[model samples]
Target: MIAVDPEEGRVRLSTAATEDRELWQFLKGLQKGEILSGTVASIESFGVFVALDDGPRHPVFSGVGFITFPELSWRRFEDPSEVVEVGQRVSCEFLQFDTRNGEARLSLRALQPDPFATFADDTEVGQTLSGRVTKLLPFGAFVQVADGIEGLVHLSELARTPVETPEEVVQVGDQVSIVVMEIDVERRRLLLSLRHA
Candidate 1:
């Protein structure tokens, strides 16, 4: 078993309850939707491991939290260091948990309202937006305006200009300005267009 020591501010691994009480307290408070403040202990390909305020010399339990790629905070840094420095204090809300395994799925992105929600709040049918292609599928392309929001440009909407497949014109990472022809709230679909705009 891995044990951590948080007696002061230094972290080390020691199999002692008196030494690791801080981590235990932090872990105990992990409830769905609970926001916990932490420190970025280290980063990895899969995700970053945070040291909770609950404490310990070594990380409470290594490899406990994640910031799924899409949920990562935008940073100007050429690398992860530009935003979150090692030992930097960070706070995030829990998005999910795997009870079978003691892991917490967390998000730094959830702190703000979703851009899709903002788009719905600000616009209506006939409003226009400048969109950039993010993903290209066989059937259509996904265009995004603000971060975290995207609209699908189906093959049928690519034109009167269409010769057949979505790839004939739309390409991944292309910028196309489109109008919000329709927004289906119940289905979370946005009927987007370039030709219509």
Candidate 2:
């Protein structure tokens, strides 16, 4: 089979014998949000590549499917290999067709339940949770309340009095107790108050 993208000035050729009509129709039928299964073809520092079953072959790479680091798993990990390994089977949500690169943008994390949803269900505003400061920004500090879940403690909420920056009250890696001020479930954002805690 042969496919050409005139705008990109690229041509792709596949030697596998298959029904031309079926192949073309199958390629056209794929849509975003579809769940597909594939084997982990390779693991890279940036992402994991999957050779999807019943999917079109990629023109340049070994696999037609790719999952970025953030999409690999629900929990944060130091490396991609920590979440997936070569030859391991995985089901991923098809995020989009990377027409420019001719690969499917897959998300393995989508198949798993969101930790934020669970956290919100278990906790409410006015509750206090102990967390370590993961990042400090000019506006506020980010505290990890649970695995894969982080809340922002706004600068105004950091102290009883006005503060210039988050650094005045907290630093990265500092253990602090934070009170949940607001929980925006739709946005998946947790507004915390260090002063109230």
Alpha-carbon TM-score of each model against the true structure: 0.65, 0.76
User: Model 1's lDDT to the true fold?
Assistant: 0.66
Report the C-alpha lDDT of model 1 over 89-116, residue by residue, as the tens digit. Answer: 7788887653433446677767755656
Residue 166's lDDT within candidate 1 is 74
The reply for model 1, stretches above 4 Å from the true place, is 1-26, 56-66, 70-85, 95-99, 171-175, 184-189
* Clash count, predicted structure 2: 0
Candidate 2 per-residue C-alpha lDDT over 96-146 given as tens digits, one digit per residue, 9 for 90 to 100? 865545567899999999898999999989999999999999999999999
> Which stretches in model 2 have alpha-carbon errors above 4 Å?
1-25, 43-47, 76-79
* Model 2 root mean square deviation, Cα atoms: 5.3
